[model samples]
Each structure stands twice: as C-alpha cells, then as structure tokens.
Target: MNTGAVVRLTEATGVGRAVVGGKAAVLAELSVAGFAVPAGFVVTGAAPDDPELGGWMAEEAARLGGPRFAVRSSAAAEDLPDASYAGLYETRLDVPADRLAAAVRECFAAADSPRVADYRRNRGGDAAAMAVLVQVMVDAVAAGVAFTAHPLTGDRRQTVVTATQGFGEALVSGQAIGEEWLSTGHRATLSRRGPARVLTARQAEEVADLARLVAERYDGPQDVEWAIDRDGRLWLLQARPMTALPPPVSWAVPGPGLWMRNFRLGEWLPEPGTPLFATWLLPLLEAGYLDGMQATVGVRVPFRWTLVNGWYYNAPPVPSAALLVRVLRDGRRRAVTILFHALVQVGRDPAAADRAVLSALDRQWREQELPRYRRLVTVAAAEDPAADPRRLAEIVDQLGRHAGIALWYLAIVGGSAWKMEACLTRFARRHLAEVLPDADGGAQILLRGLSGAAPAFDAHAVLSADWYHPVAAELPTITAVTQSGDDRQSALAVARTAAEQRCAAALADRPRRLAQFETLLRVTQRYTVIREQQARTFTLAWPVLRRCARRLGQHLAEIGAISAIDDVFFCTRPELDTTATTDHAALTSAVAERREQWERQRRIAAPLTLGHPPRLIGDVIERTVQRARPAGTTAEHGSEVIVGHPASAGQATGPVRIITDPRDFPTFAGGDVLVARATAPAWTPLFARAAAVVTDGGTLAAHASLVAREYGIPAVVGTGNATSRLHSGQRVTVNGTDGTVTVHP
Candidate 1:
C-alpha cells in the first residue's frame, strides 16, 4: 500500500487521469470516499515492464491475503465524459500473483488490438493511453449494473438496476440476460423477473441508494457496476458517467388543471405541428373561446392553449382566484361602458350587443377574404411568375391574411359549438339520464331530429357520393334532389319517433324545463351547423394554398432549389421566402438538410403533456362535462383492452384499418374498424363504410365523435396511440359505451 509506479487504489488521490486513467481515478475517489471498494493497486504509465511492479504486486497480495487478482485496462480515454471504453478494453480475471505483471502487460497491449482499434475508429477516440488496474476480485453471488435514472425515459426520479448471477462481465458483455428492477425512494418494482431473482428487495434498495449517492457526487446519472458477495457484503467494482442521456424534460404542469390533447385541432394537424401553425393560427382560435367567455359571463378565463409533441393540448389557466376576480371586474366594467355607450348613441338600443355578436358570425368571407385568395390563385396559375417577385410577395401576404380570417371565424364557430355541446352534455347528465337511459342514444335522437338543420349532414351526403374528392375545385351538389328528399323524410320520421320516446316522460313531468331544454338544443344545433360550415370553408382554402405552395415548389425544383416539389413543406416560412432571392444551391442544400431533420422528428412520439399534466382540482364545469363515463365503471378484464373516451355508443367487431392519410382510404373495406391518429372533416366519408371508429385523439365534441354518432358506429376516441397500437387487418371488438377496444390475438 505505497505510492510508487504502482500506487494502492485508496492512496492514489491527486493522480491525473492521464497517468492512472479515468477508471482508476473513479475507483480511487470511491475508495477515498469510504465506499466498499476492493483492495487494489493501479499500475500507471505504459506497459508494466518495471521490475518494481512484480514486487508491488507481491506486497499487495500479502496485504489482501490472496494470490488471485483481476487485471483490467484503464486507458486515459476510458470512462471519460464522452467515451466509456466499457467492454471494448481487455480484462484478465483471476490472474495468479506470479502472472500479475504479464496480465498488466496484456491489458496494456489490448490498446493496439484490432477490435479496440475498430471501436476507437468508430467512436472517434484516440489510441488508448494505457494504465492497468489490478484488484482483489469478488466471488459474486449476484452482480450487475445500475443507472441512477431511467435511461430510456430519462425519468430522473427513478433508479434502474439490471442484475444477474455470477460476474457482471457476463451481463455487460451481453452473454446473459438479467432481471430488471426500478426503484424510487423506498419502493422497488421488478420489471423483468429472470429465471432466478438476483437480489432481494432490501438488497435492491441498498444498491439503488449507493447508485444514487454516486450519481449525486458525479453531478449526473452514473452507470454503476456492483457485486453482492455470498456473505451479503456489497462491493463497488466500477462507476462512470452515464453517456447519451436524453435531455431532461421540464415536467411542470402548464396550469392547475389537467391539460389533454383534443382531436378537433389534433386531427387537422396530423403531422408534427409547425411553429407557425401553433403560434400564429392556433392561439387565434383559442382566443375566440376565451374572448367569448369574457363577453358572455363577465369572466375572462385564461387558457394555456399550446402544442405538445405536435398535438394541441387544452390546458386550463392559472388557478388564481385573485386573477379571476380581477378579470371579472374588468369584464364587467367593459360591459357596463359598452351598454352606456350604446344607450347614449342609439337612445337605448337594447339589442346592440346581440347585433354585434351576430355581425361577427355573419362576416362575409366570400366577399372579403375569398376574393383575395381567388385573385392570388388566378395570378399564380398563369405562366412563369418568377420574374415578378413583388407580385408573388403580394400574393403570399394576401394568402396569409385570408387564411387568418378563415381560421379566426373557424375558431369562433368551433369555440361556440364546444360551449353549446358542453351545456347540452351537462344538462343530459344532470336531468335526462333517467329518461334517456343511453346518453349516446339520446344524442343520436337529438342530432337526427336536427339533421336537416345541420350543414354537416348535407356535407356528409355530398361527401358520401362515390366520385366525391376533397381537393376538387368545386364541391359536388346533390343532383338527385328527389331521392335526397325521400331519404331526409325517412331519417326525420325515425328521428321524431326516437325523440318522442326519449323526451315524452321528461316533457310531461317538467314542461317549462323541457321548453328551455328544447331552446338550448335548437341553439346547439345551429352552432353545430356553423362549426361544420366554417370547417368546410376553411378546408377549401387549404387546397388553394396547397396549390400555390406546390406551384412555388415546382418553380424551385426547376431552379434546382430542392430535390422535389413536396420538399417545400420541410422548409420553414422564412426559408421558403428566401427562395425568391437566395441562390439555388444554398436553398437546395438547406431544404435537403431540413427534410432529413423533419423525417427524424416524425419518428418521435410527442409527449401529451410538456411536463406532467396538471393535477385536477375544484368543481370546474369543464372537467365534469368532459368525463367519458360515470365514476366506478369497471375496466374490461383483458391485457389487449385499450381504454379511451366513449365518443359514440355501440358495439362492433371488425378488422382494423389504420389510416394515417386520406390516400389510404381505398384500403378501408366496409366493416373495418377505422384506427386513425385523428380524423378531420375530410375523413368523414370513411365513417359511412367503417363498422367502428377508434382514434388516437378526440373528445365527445370532436368531428370524429359527431360523425360517429351520426353513423351510429361504436367509437372510442383519445386512445392516444390507437393507430400505432392497432395494426391493419387485426381483428378487434370495440365497445363505445365502455370505451374499450379488445384486440383479438
């Protein structure tokens, strides 16, 4: 135990990593810190040809009381922040004291081995600057590695341990499978139980504690190797920095209430949402609802409207009563000021506020926004407009403005529709459950009665036509008016019967309440129609914009600014703007690089909540209305049963048809269960042919839910990963009322 060419592991402090190497430095540090490390000596410098090395080994053997020792390569580059040589280096185990010098020489010579050279070349490391560590090897009862954090999930709160019997080298070298355990605080759970349990619960906790300590000392996660001797004594063999940890996620909830992804917005944004869409377009839509609440109730409720993982999340605002009170007071004062102004200007125009709301709803998009869009399209369709950069710039400006107008109105209609739907749902839950029995049935009855009044019904009819297509310049009209009229009459008759049967008892018992409910229901229907109209109108603009983008893309391709026309989507708006003046080679390279990055992003699942979703609190009406089912509904007993919100009520079993794009529609056969990431208005036509509907994102008021209710197909929405989980042609049973999809093996 002396400081020489070979220093005792415990006494080797202040020795630089370049001399004793990264592994020796860590071991020495652990020994100095009073961790249970084995007696060892580090042979510093190059190959251990020194005559003193043999004498030092003999002295170490006498102090440790054993001839057997493990000689390990500890290169300067090993266990560094960027490089963990790991199994790439040599380890000669159970070397006799006489062969210790030869073992050290062999360990050093491993630096020049072909495999080590290849590994260094691949990992971009220098040739190993050799040092050899000789230690009194433990005869292990159980041995393995532990991580202070969940490596894959990057969950810092948990420690993961992988253990197997015998040497940890077997597990590390992938020669043996191991049992896995995840520990947090005093709790430890076995994730994978191997043939034999390697460690007891208490032992696992002890290991986790030690690992956590090492990780803390290192100021990051640590990959620790440990051995539990037959006598139950724990020994630390190696500890190094964990490499390539995923970036730590900030798990703070956006607000005080749980934020969930809504399919209404998510369906429209099927791919990863772009910043422009999330920042510019989505906020405008969210503001419409927030503003509407302020106008109607004198309460300016805030919303954390954001995109998480490219999906839209409806986050509740801060739960501050003082903030709410202040907003209410301001809203009330503003309302009083408006009322007084209206009285002064028009001598008590009582309906001024109503007129104002009506005006907002009735603004003529066709007269103002659509005309500009049309003009742009007309100009862009003409030959070689690249010569006129100013004209193109004007068209781009017009396109953005027009799209904004469309989005603004769409948000207004959508937000209003959601409010109305929530009201209806709340009323049904409070009053109509006893009479209707089935909430989905009741909704269908009400919806069918108002079918003639909903533009969505007409739109569905047009969409149902065999030749109908979304990108068509003009939507097809119902040419067979007589047949449509007959179909409507039949549907109305059925709807009337269903409604009468459901509402008769309620109406008889509470006539006034029934009348009030009827009025609300009618208003809800009107809002629903407006929502569908705005969605359809807004969608029409997409084809126009898409055409323009493609045109520009084609021009860029001609100038060699991109590999293909579709590559334009990979470029940001500003990058696309540069195409007007930037050099072709630079633009092309940028687009190609961006395309690669975009493809990589598409593969990652975006977290539903940026941080942990906020905890539920208070008696918020939104929470009550959004519940998919009554409390204490028993979960279906099956491993394959996927739970989701019951959007539409029915039961059906069919082969799954996973549709990510409309282009995949032809693959959908009748009686197939449609499994989609989300569904847009454009996807409505598929409902008519599908036996059941399952979506990754949506709520009761989402387009898929509404359409599913209309089609009377069983639907479970907001499954979060239905498209990924359910494979095409896999048979499954969907229970919409139970909100479960049982996959068949």
Candidate 2:
C-alpha cells in the first residue's frame, strides 16, 4: 500500500489487514457480509508522518462529492475483548468538505491524548498507530448501540439495542440514553405502545444475528454500533470486546422488602422526630418563604376537592437530596408566572376564590419552599452558633413549633393540591368539552392561564364609580358629604402607592423566612442527617419540646372535624353522594387501588405500622384525632361574616353569598359577597363583581387578595376556613387590625 494514499476498508482489509483498527475492520466484515456499506477511505498512521497524506485524503474526499462525512477515530490497539476505548477519542460528525483533512488530524491528536494513553495503560494495551476512517454519511432511518449480552446483568440470553430518532451518536456520546429491553434474540420491528412504550419484538433476533457474525469474525463478545439506512439494510460501523460482566442475580423486585434499600426519602422530606430541630426551624420564620415559591420553583400543586381523591404519583421520582441541592444551585430557574402566582397567593384571601388558588399556594410552599428551607436549616444548625443560653432555648422552642406548623401546612397543602387538579380536570370535562377534546392536558393549560394575571380587575374604577362595589352603600355618608376631602385624589393615590410598597416589601420577605422554616423542618425530619452527623462525632443538640397544641392551633387557621387513624398505613376512600357533584364511586375504587399501591411503594418501617385489620384501620384512624379547630378558641357570635388573612389593610362588609365552588357563579350577583375556599385561574371571572374577598389561607400577595386590591376591595386571608367560620347571611365586622373577625349578634 502507498503510505500517503487512501484506501477503502474493503480494499485494505481484504488484502492488507493490519493497517486499520477494529472499527474499520468490522465495517469491512459487514461489507463482505452482503450489507450496504458507505464508500470510505481509511487513512492509516502514515498520515501523521507524511503531511501530504492529509491533502491527499482531502482531495479524495472532494472527489467523492463531499457533502460531509463522519471522521471517526480507530486506534489500531483499541476495541479488544478486554477493553473498548469508546469516547476516549473523537468522532467529528457532519464535517465540512474543506475541513475533512483538519477533522481527521484533530481525531489523530485526540487519539494520541494522555487520556487515551492512560486508558490503554489501565486496560493492558500499548499506544499504537491510529487510523482515520472517512465515510460517506448515511441518511439513517434508525440508529442505535447494541450489545450482544446484557451489559448491566451479563445475561447472554438477551441482546439489548436502544434506538432513538436521528443520529445514533447522541446515544453513544451521553447526550441521550435510549429505552432498553431484554430480548430472545429475534429480529422484530420496534413500535411505541401505551405507557410502557418501545415494544421491540424479534429485534432481538437481528441483534443476535449481528452479534453472531462479530463473534465468528472477531472471536469474542462485541459491543456493536449499528444503523439501518433508508434502503432497509443493517450495517455495523464499529464493534469492540466487552470489558467486564456483572455477576448474575434476579434483579426484579420480589414483593415486600425486596428493593426497599433503593428508596431515598431524603429527597422528599426530613425524617420524623429527629432531635435536631435547629436546622428545621429558621425558614419557617422567613418572610418570603410562602410567596416567591411558585416563581422560584416549577410544578405548582393543585388544592381542590376533586383533586383530594386523585392519585399522587410523581413520574420518574425527584432526585436524591444531593441532586436536588445541586439542581437548586444550577440553571433550572423557575418561570416568571410561577413566581407571580406564588406571590399572589402569599398573603391573599383563600376563601373568596375557589379551591384552585389555595391549592397552588400550598403546593409552592410544600415542594419548593419546604425543600430549600430544610437544607438551609440543616446546614445552619450544623454550623457554630454564639447565641445566649436563654435565646438558644427560645429558638429551640420556636423551631419545634415551626416544625409542627410546617407538618400541618404540608398536609393541608398536599390535600388541596390534589383536589384542585381534579376540580380543574372535572370542570374541563363537563364545561369545556366543546373547547377541549382531551382533558389530559387540562391541568397544564389551566396552570398556564392562572400563572399569568390574565384577567385584569379595575379596582379604582369600581371604587370611584361605586359601580361593582358591594360595600359602596354600606359606608356612612356625612351630612352634605363634607368628608374632609382635601386633595383627595392625590392623597388617595399617594397612600395607595405607599400601601402597595408595604405589600411589595412583605411579598419580597416571604422567600427568606420560608427558607428558614424549611431548613429547620429538614433537620428535624431527617434521621440520616442525624446519624451521619453523629457518626462524624458531631454534637447532636437536644430537641426542645414545645406545646404541640398551641403550635397546631397557630399553624392551622381553621380546623374542621378531625379523624384519628388507628393505622396510618391503611387508607380508605370516603363515600359521598351525587349531591357532592363528584363521580365518587369511580374515584373511590380508583383511589382504593392506588392507596394500596402507594402504601406498598412507601413501605414504612414495621415499627411505624399498627397491627390493625386493614378494613377497619381507615375509619378507626379518623376517629382517633381531636376534631380540627382553627387557632384561637374564643366564643363565636351568631352573625354573617367572612374571615381571612389580613391581605389588604382594610375591610368592608356586604351581602354574603356562600359558594362552595367556581361553578356557583350564577348565584353571585354583582356586588354580592363571594365566599369560597380559594380562587383559581378560572375563578377570575367573579373577581370583578365581588365587594371584598376573604379566605382561610393566603398572604397579602395571594391572587384573590391582589385582585381584590386591584379591584379596590378589602380582603382578609389566612383565617383558616373562612367559609366554615363565617355563616351564610350573618352580619359581622372583619377587623383587619390585629387580624381578628368579630360578629355583631
């Protein structure tokens, strides 16, 4: 062979076999196997010594009508039975016609890198001359990397090939990893099927056939890269030996406790009842913890009745704690609308709107705020502190209470998120059927709209014109309307700006405070952290026992009847009639099956499980807890009232109309009081007509509270269950000052 001349793998390997690497050798073998092989010239190690070889190869590539060929590295010493030096060198895809020579040279350099040398040394090989393979790129119909035996478990009975759309390089280069399967070595075509997807029947046979050819020629098990062109012919571009095999074992989970070791709860929450409360308490005290979550974190939780019954399953599961902390530090910043919605729900009225807003806020707090807060608390507590003994004691006490409050909040938020998702889905199913054919994507659509403040409210116009103001007539007018109104317009505008500033300040502070609480929660909940710290010989602080009763009251604004569970492990589906406007029968059955599965999946330690009969466990648990009550056990006056958090700094009274859902819109006349659990994107339609809004959960930044303020209506939020606390038609005064609701009996 001429040292500077380029030759086809077929030509060179057929006559001069020692010139190229295993990759080109396999291509030559495939060419001989009656498979379609692209025209390619192999430039051997002679190119490195003779500069003229580069120009000759480029000229040759130009002669072949160079659209772009793959310039891949093929080291003569590589792709042996003991090692496949994959990805140690370079493969430049779609190289330009003029740049083919340069690309080939770069591959030569890469193949000669220290990494390649180290790999060769470790795998018991010598650095030898490299070959440059320049091939006409095939317009691949399908492409993948195949193994003759299972690389993971070393099962020779199965051959695995993971295919993806477009080029197969992505699969090899770690840009993408394809779906895989175990096959009986049959050559069946692959197709997408249901949730499991990628059904490859008989494809295994084709893989094995290829593998058999490789083993016959190369005398060992080979890792092969194959591609099918538009003409329906399989061509093997490269093949190498398997390095090592996994010890055989049954990998599938065999009932309970089989793969329990794999579960990582640290990614989700802190372990319950850890003595380290210091790490969990601080974020609860952060001001910004609640509001900025939706904006800072993606994935809003839905809080509604229908969703309460929906199955809670996160696909592919969240990352481990280490990964989450990394993600938090990395580039996945949350969308703007999420933050906006989160801010809106921060201190807004939860009762005035439907269940949707309540759910969203709850979800934000739980998933985003809580996780970060937990990490923060954990890290902070582990660090040195210089606080006085009394102050430290007080802080410990505060942390304990904070954990309790967080737990309660999380439960409420989780329940609300599930319900909201279901409610929106059901709404889309029943009402938006004409508009939306597929209800599956409804929640996503709803969330998109809700995230944006799509529906604007004209609060100033309403208040000025007394047009849609429910409390317009309720305000007492002085004789001759001499209301001491000097520069009323400017003063009102200035005052409003100042008030808005204060609200904005409060909104901004939520995330930080939330971080504090979340950290403490994490420290308290994670047993692993405690053990890990202890093993490191770190001092574990004694937990301060705070009154759970007071903390529970503070966290839960309103408590309805509470059910005690004799067995927390066993869950039940409650029965409801058609009057509840739900498909309860279908839901209960679905939930029952799901609950059992989830419990199995969760697999709480045996110590945590109560040895009660499964059927009676649900009801008995419900009966054991004290009836849920809101904070403050003061006597109630018989009156119509709407109670909520002090979102806006003022309150106005008007006619009360109790609405349990967003569908109860027709009953709400303009200026009539709107009462509900929470608001959602769909519930914005009613914001224009309501006088003032009230809710059980929310900060000043909540959706209803924002719309109420924007629409110039007074709002109260975080009153717990505003609807449950306030009667239908009773007259009462909402005291925004000191955050109280008083009734005029």
Candidate 3:
C-alpha cells in the first residue's frame, strides 16, 4: 500500500482512516457523492515533516483558485461513533497561501495536544494518527452546524440548525451566540437566545436539506458543518456520524382515550420534575384519584401517570372489565367511559358529585384540617430548624400529610369541577341558548356571581400585603387582624357589587327556567369557590416542603455529601436517603451529572402529551413553543396570534413581563401582562397588578385562571409556549374571551 503522502480529496480513492483520518475520509466520500464540498486536498502523517509539503500546498491552493485556505485536523480518532473531538483539535481558517504549510504543521501538531490526548484517553482510544485537510476557504456570509436528527430528544423527524453571521468559529468556540432554527421539512422555525437572526427561513430549510442529504447518504443521522458564501451557494464544510444519539423515541399516536396534560396537577409542576419528587408524588396522586373513583363508582380504574420530558402526563387508563362490559351493552357508554371517566366514577351526575365533594371538604376544613394546618404553620414558623431538627422533620411530615389530604380533595375538586363545567356548558348551550347564547358567557356570569362568596378573594387580599413579600418564609404572626379584616371587607364589597350586576343581567327575562337557572348558579358558585380554596390550601404545603428540602440540603452540605445545599434537589430520594448519613464521592458526581441533565432538559420542549407532541416547523411542541410566532409573519413583523383556552374574560394589550422564576416577582411592574410557564397560589399577588396573564401551561380551572377571573383581567392559559415565545418589553394583546394573544411588532 504505497499511498502517497498527499492526496487530492476528490481522488483519494481507497484511502484508509489511518492515513487520511476520519474527517478527511468523510469529506472525500462527500465530494465523490457530489455534495458541494469546497475543493481540498489531504496531507497525510507521512507528509508532516516533508519540506516539499509547501510546494504541494501552493499547487492545491492555485488549483482551487483561492489565496486563503482552511487547514483542519482530521485525526484518526476524531469524529468516532462514540466520541466527537469537536473543538478539541485546531482548525485554522483564512490562512494566506504563504502560511498554508505552517498551518498544516500546526494542524498535525494538534494530534499531540493535551486536550486531544485527554479526550482520547477518556474515550479509551489510543493516540490518533494525524492527517491535515487543506481546503479553499469559503468566505461565508453565514455558517453553522446542523444535525439531521434533533440533537436532544433524538427525534429523527426534526433537523436542528444553529447558525451565526461571518464565520462558524465564533459559534464553535462559544465566542458569540447564534440563532437556532428547527426544520421539520420545508418549514423552518427560528429562535434566538439573543435578538439577532443570521439565517432566513428559506436559508435555514436549505441548510437542513443539505444536512438531510448528508445523513441519508451516510445511512444514519449526521452532524454536519455548513456555510453559505457571499454569493449564496450552500457548502458542506464537514460531516461526521452523530455521537451519543438519544435512544429511539416511540411516539404514541393520539387515540380515543382521555389524554390529560397541563391540567389538574400539571399546572403546579412547571419544570422538569426531579425524579425523587416524581417517584413519591405521582404515585400518591394516582392512588388518591383511584381511591376516589373506587369509593364513588365501586370499581377500580387504573389512574396511571408518567412524566414525559419532566412534565406530568396522565396516560390513558386500561379499560376495566366493567367498562368493557358497559361498552358491549351500549356504545354510548364506552364514549362516556373514555371521555368523562370522572363523571362515570361519580355515578354520572356531576352536580351531585360536586355537592358531595364540596360538602366533604367543608366539613373537613371546619372540623379538623384547617385548624390543624394553621397550628402546624404556627409551630413551623416559631421553631427554628437549626434549634430542633427532629421537630422540624416532624413538622415537615405533618405538613406533607396535610398536603396529601388536601391533594386528595383537590383531585376530587378538579375532576368534579371539570365535569360540572362540561355539563353546565352542554346544558346551557342546548337548553338556555335563547337566554344565554354564549355557553362560556353564561358560565363566566355564574363564576363571577359566585366570586363574592369565595374565601380565596380574602386570602388573595391578605397575601397582597407587605408582610407576605417573601412567601417562602413562614407566615408572619398577625399582631393585628383588623387590617386583614378591613381589606377583606373592601374586597367583598367590590366582589358583591360585580356579582350582583352580572347575575342580574344573566337572569333578566328568563322567567320560564328561573328556578332551575338559579339552582345551577348556586351549584356552580359553590364548587368554583371551593376549587379556588382547595388549590390555595394545597399550595401551603409547598413552601414548607421547600424549606424542609433546603434544611436537608444544608445538612448534606455540612456533612460534605454534596457540594452545595441546593445540589440536594438534583439527587434522587433514594440517593438522598442513603447518602444523608454517609459521605460518598459518587453522590457528588451523580449530583453534577443530574444538574447537567436538568440543564439539558430545560432546553427541551416537553411534549404536551406523552406520545406525539404537535410538531411545528419540524421541532416538538416544547421547542417550538418559544419560537412560535404568529403564522405568515417574520419575527420582526407580523400579526402572529396564539390561541389557547380562555380562562378569564377580558382583553388587554400591554408589554409582556416573562417570569420563569418566582424570585423575579419583585421585578413585576403594575399593568404588565404576566407571562410564565405556570402560576401557583404564591403567584397570586402578581395577578392583582397584572393587566392580563398568558401561560404556557394551565387549564380553565388552573390557579392562574381562577385568580385572573377574580382580578377581572384577560387571561389565556395553556398557550403551551407563552413563556418561551413572548419576550419582556414586547407588546401583546390578550383577548381572554377569544382565547387568543396577538403579538405586536
């Protein structure tokens, strides 16, 4: 095998990896396959010390008709299936022809660089043979890297492209930020961490097309480097097998069963959930719902739930024997069983179920739970964790139990409320169309009328005070109850006036069904108020749990089980349980690994449902949510509108204030349209000052919805990406009645 020291990349036939190296071989193959690779030649390790290499370089440069050349390292170990020596070796670009030989030597020398050596060692590879690839430099207007499959989440249907202006070096070296484009096919969606876009939609799709071609040719997903020259010709700079491809994802097609996401428990848990929390919390929740169903319906239906990309999702339950028998007897029963299991579980009477659940909650609140929770809150506040760790743990346990009970009722409340609303909407639309033409309008009127009776309004007023500025701390001991009383009275007065006016208009001229309408109104108000009260009460456990977790975190940090107190969040419950009393190096490593995983998960757009997330511009629903602008408009200009469920009935246009973390609460200004992943009860205070609200996750019965309705502000919930799509200072008009948010340029 007397292969020459130098080989023309286009004519490098039968060149082995050991000679031409992995990258040069791939380029050679691509060039042969007719890809738009810049004309280049490879200089093997045999030529690294050859004095005549300079003559060869000049000939190649002249043949390519370029004064500047790119000298890139193509080590044998580079771009391996298991490892990508990306940015570990030297790549010298825009080198004058006179310095091409020196650049080649520099590229060859990169094989011995400490970083490359360490990288290879880590991957269990021996020293790599160096081959330098010299190509005519393409003066790029834009350059970037693209993956045929989504680099994260491993969705093969999507292509992820990241590009920046001028050169790829800036993006590769992390010196400058770049715009990201996700291309599914012909359509491309553009997103930016910073405010500049380097590639247009057409350009992005073109780049993605080239990448897909490379991947198809290679017979697997490819990580491709691409550039567009000043004349607008797309060029493939390099291509390599994608390393560490995510395991194949099996997406479930939408089916007949009930698929729940961004509703009930989903709204409260906005981030990618920690494993420990998911392990303990999800099962308990499932059990609670199961118990409720068993108690009400006398049959056990599986209430299975799972986390997809860290978001809670309830999987469609397996049909029970009773359900199957019912289906055989009546087709309508099957539809009802699949769609409205909550109603079926509660004897198929939503109003009765509402009454039963609300009555039980009222009794519990009055007899035992409310007083016990209040006393515990006082004890938790008064006794410092540092002074009494045992007592602190005991209080945390008690708080958890209280929260669990509340959650059980919340499950009932959420299900019953949804069923009740569905029934009410159906009845109003069918029977009361002449009296209340808009079913939603009729429901809104009833909700508003019931608002005056809600204790949640009083809680909101009390929470709005300065003492509650830091909600994470234990509630302050009220030295004087008069201020809260006066605020409550004022709130009640305002609510009562609004309710009376709204109810009068709703009931005006409905003489035939007056009594029935009034009965419906009373039931709707009672359940709606109870829903709000239970949700608020359930959240009280969160601050306590958070504090307990922090304390545990501190203990771990003091004992050197983890590096920091907050790192405890990254550990699994089992890991925490075992490592709490013992110090282990693996625990630290695991925490660090989990932190990285969490950071990556943050970048992923979790699918709205477990199976197949809606794809917009080739990316999953999660990734596209932030980048989604109104259709048929560019980011700089367009009348892009986002549609969601209208939770509150009003309309307002204002600058958006994107709040991802509660710590940013202080920065919220009066009248700013609040945008977040989701809002909890702790977020109630912001609603008071917000002109409108938009969220990526929530339902008509979500905390944000209830609060927004009470505040009489426009709110659109479950926009699925409002937090990611809308930026602070951008003006958006939120129409709660229409459930649409139109972004203004």
- Number of the top-ranking candidate, with TM-score as the measure: 3
Candidate 1 vs candidate 2: the lDDT winner is 1
lDDT of 2: 0.44
Q: Candidate 1: global Cα-lDDT?
A: 0.64
- lDDT (10s digit) by residue, model 3, range 79-110: 87778888998999999988988888888777
Task: Please list the C-alpha lDDT of all candidates, in the order they appear.
Answer: 0.64, 0.44, 0.67
**Residues 1-745, candidate 1, lDDT per residue (tens digit)?**
5545777887777777788888998999999998999888888873355667677778777787766888898888988767787788789987888888788888877888888888889987667567889999898889999999777546788898888998888888888767777798757765544445578777888899999999889998999999998899999999998886665434455555556556334445545554334443345445544544454436555556655444456655655778657765776765445323322321122124224452344354435654665565456446224534345435544554554455555554343554555556556667787765453454444654344333242332222111112343233322211112234435744864666567756777898878767766666666565566666665443444444556666767777778887766555556666676877777668767655544444444444443443354643323433454554564453335787777777789999888764556666777899988667665665676688999877666667776676566788887766665556777889988768898775
* Candidates sorted on TM-score, descending: 3, 1, 2
Residue range 421-441, candidate 2, lDDT tens digits: 333334334434444333122
* Best lDDT among the predictions, by candidate number: 3
RMSD of each: 10.5, 25.0, 8.3
For model 2, the run of ten residues with the poorest summed lDDT = 304-313
Please identify which of the two predictions, 2 or 3, would achieve the higher TM-score against the true structure: 3
Clashing residue pairs, backbone N/CA/C < 3 A, model 3: 184-618, 605-622, 626-724, 626-725, 630-640
